[model samples]
Target chain A: MAIDFKQDILAPVAADFAAMDKFINEGISSKVALVMSVSKHVVEAGGKRMRPIMCLLAAQACGENDLTQTQRLAAVIEMLHTATLVHDDVVDESNLRRGRPTANATWNNQTAVLVGDFLIARSFDLLVDLNNMTLLKEFSTGTCEIAEGEVLQLQAQHQPDTTEETYLSIIHGKTSRLFQLATEGAAILVGKPEYRQALQQYAGHFGNAFQIIDDILDYTSDAETLGKNIGDDLMEGKPTLPLISALSKTSGTDHEIIRKSIATGGLTELDDVIRIVQNSGALDYCRLRAQQETQLAIDALAILPESIARQGLYNLAMLALDRIQ
Target chain B: MAIDFKQDILAPVAADFAAMDKFINEGISSKVALVMSVSKHVVEAGGKRMRPIMCLLAAQACGENDLTQTQRLAAVIEMLHTATLVHDDVVDESNLRRGRPTANATWNNQTAVLVGDFLIARSFDLLVDLNNMTLLKEFSTGTCEIAEGEVLQLQAQHQPDTTEETYLSIIHGKTSRLFQLATEGAAILVGKPEYRQALQQYAGHFGNAFQIIDDILDYTSDAETLGKNIGDDLMEGKPTLPLISALSKTSGTDHEIIRKSIATGGLTELDDVIRIVQNSGALDYCRLRAQQETQLAIDALAILPESIARQGLYNLAMLALDRIQ
Candidate 1:
């Protein structure tokens, strides 16, 4: 499904996406070459490029196929997303990302941080160039929500009694906000308010499912496919949905072991923790919940006219659920 | 002169400025209380509150007396400036600020960074509330420039070959951009375009003088008065204007010691390094240059009508220069 969607939908826009990459690379000036280099390094390192592609595809779906604004906005969203990742690596203290050393690990924390600031600044500069006040305001608000989400996550970390509502709020702030903004910004730029709202709802639910699956994958996927070591979230003491839900369901020794591991934030005996989660049916439960969200995300698109882009988005949501299992 | 100015002008607005503080404190929401608390702790630690005051005075100096927008813009500038300080503390890894434990040292780098981000986000949110796109664009651009400047400074650190032009650019980026923005934003809000340009010039030149004196003070001032250790810049290997000028002028053994000390970034033999800078006449040269810039700043205010606020601005610029000495 993923292969077919990528070949048919993402292929035509691949060159435009490449052009957006080139635009960002050229955007960082020579005066801050070091920061630009570090920023470019992290950006150029392969990711799914899912957010930018969604942005461009959303624009295409809206029928305002002006590739200029579409491409620029695509680059802007991607850069903003990448900036958050660079800072996240520092906050998480994770050494590896996307199968390679994180920028913070490669360069010291200081450089990583300043470079993150540079990318964020660059994102704003690009947005300002678009001269759309509404778009600027929305993007700026999105950035703020993203920051608040990160702070929420920081507050949530290592706390065993975190509630599901709080967990959802954190995911909404951290993941869904940007996804919603990416599609919504595209729709706004193309003057499709109804479609923009629909796309926003689509992206928001899709993002929630995507992040849940990501957290679940941390438990079920091994080091190779997951890029970094498995149980990293546990090591970081991130009480993700699966673990939180699993903890709520379990009792006695199972609960105590999970609580102790979260408190210590060390996974020397990873197999034991994984066994508890799997045996408790938390992984299956998480997959089921993710599937539900994916369905809702697809449902949000019911108002929009059916197009290849809309289908691709639906496939993307399904792919997120499928990848987790 | 400083005593009289502070007693008369600053003391009166001290009440109005105190109101601005309430606005800032109220701006942080309960949802992100932890992050906001950390931000407020640093902001309220009793730095002079000079920047916001400058914003208020600049607006008043233009002969417009609606204090509402001026007060809000002042708070916005102060929040933006405070955010940079929080991030700067993380970048510098400094432990003490304003006679208290630095936020980064007390809370941890993650909190410092995210809290700083929160403040920045809040600054924009406030700007959006003002519904002035001109101020928002100007302020946002100023922020991006400030980040770029800091990135340049990070790269320039430990490099002895940094030019005077580069040094000026860095200081302008780090200090003057926001200084200019504070005054200019106020003027724009108050509907005084001519005064806005003049105030921007005044603030820009004043900021340069202020920063130059600050660097000089880092070399010559005592720890008790400065609230920071002398040679803190040297320890950080920051090639401030004084050090850069001294490096260019000195030759033979003195030049080698200065270069090596900057390269290594320490004050193990403090007296010796001070002696090199003193013998090179770098400290005196920097003071003379700062005085010249302060005069230039005062001169830039010539277009404004003769008013107490204008006099207050003049007094503040003089106070900045005198405080360094």
Candidate 2:
């Protein structure tokens, strides 16, 4: 049976999710009109809000009652996520995100950059209000790693020599680190130290699996299917996992094409590159890796008490895998 | 009295300033080569390190004996200031800062933006290590206002209707708030609650005066003297204090010219705008405002006991006013 995201994953924290959404709107409130409008635009453009949902579920799985502070944490997680996306759009020079005009697109790079800075500052301000030293440290360190990951990705751009280890480091920083912060932060807030490691492990593997699947789709899916154009990564010469794996498996002309495509990012030989990636068993290896990661993510949740929220956490991991399947 | 910066302002805290400079280099260390290099570049491009100097002096004036953690706080203040400058360069598309190529110019906007982000996160990470909730709250809130102030300035760009009130609000966020954080944060960290208000008042008014002087220089000074071009603000159509005051004090073509120049940023009417700004008594009004702010800054230091550090703060304010005199 196919899993339904709304029924199996978000259902456990539906009310809290609603409350968290409200808090996000409140959290981004600013006296500056442009800041408010840009923040509102990007926040409204948000999809699924999976990170905050994971935070809420982690709080519930820890068996916490009365989640007033938990809702705020959820909101902060989402705001941080939104802030990154806004900056990412400016970096990518993207005009459309989730079928809507991005903040950079609507205003300009200056507005996007400054508003993104405001969101980041506001997120920390709200986190400080939570008054947890450990949580603050975790988030502060996590954000640094996230930024390093982004710069590493930029460094790897057009360098086909980037290895899988480097790729893992990049994905871990850019994607999984925040996921760890989300669930692990909830554990810290709820005063459940024992559950922190498990949730972190769950979210870490889940984030890796999710990003790998995203990269794989860049080779396989189209703009209509994923809301992200196929070959987007290739066009940027980003040596993602599939391309890296394809380099390892292929030889001679096949390898040269992939290498050259990465060194000089564009879609000139996109069809040939995609065909090579598919034929060289690179996509198969990526699928296997994604499955393993998803399994590890689900297995990590075993330490948490059995509850609907825990089930929801398990289902969210599986749902991510379902996208590639 | 020439108010030599080296002799009067920096002498009292010169040793601690050295320690803080070392701390700044160590603080920017990163596992990622690109992040480290970009951060190092911008930090090296920094000017006289005024903000951190103010922080160190504030610590000494508060009667703090041990300067260990105070040095780290000073480093954090400088890092935060550098981070803002990095982002500002990107926002303004500036090629040089203090005659050194900017991060965006040396690398790219993507690198500059991401590295700027890394610096911000690193600053917060270091701040979290200090384990002071009140200080963290102050910085977290202050950074938000700083970003909002930047966005407000961007909104006022090409907008001639901007008032003196709005211009003050802009400068407060863009320039003075960090100054407040530098001094006020030192007071918070030193456990000198009594001095926090006085230090904040001094830094806030000093910041206002310092920025007003810088704006005045934009009309009067050139690259050879200030490392900033004349009419740079007018070139960007920024309705800064001089331009705002000129508009308030002029009429007919003189007023119309200033209004049109602000409405559309460029250097076509540069000479006319400067003449009106000078002849309309705008520079004198700006000079008077800067002096008043400087006086307020010095007056705020009266609450602190008579110490060399207090005198150093007084001299720093006086030195700023000397630029206009």
Candidate 1 wrongly placed segments (more than 4 Å): A1-5, B3-5, B8-15
lDDT per model vs. reference: 0.82, 0.94
Every model's DockQ: 0.60, 0.93
In model 2, what lDDT does residue B241 have? 94
Q: In terms of lDDT, which candidate is strongest? A: 2
Give the range where candidate 1 chain B is weakest over 10 consecutive residues by summed lDDT.
B1-10
Q: Model 1, range B120-140, lDDT digits (tens) per residue?
A: 777777777777767777876
- What TM-score number comes out for model 1? 0.96
lDDT of 2 by residue, B72-142 (tens): 99999999999999999999999988888989999999898988888999999999999999999999999
Candidate 1: Cα lDDT at B248: 78
Tell me the TM-score of each prediction against the true structure.
0.96, 0.99
lDDT (10s digit) by residue, model 1, range A56-140: 8888777665778789888888888888898888888878888888888888888888778777777777777777778887887
lDDT per residue, candidate 2, A1-325, as tens digits?
Answer: 8889899999988888898878898888998999998999999999999999899999999999778899999999999999999888888888998789999989999999999999999999999999999999999999999999999999999999999999999999989999999999999999999999999999999999999999999999878878888999999999999999999999999999999999999999999999999999999999999999999999999999999999999998998888888
Chain A of model 2 scored by TM-score: 0.99
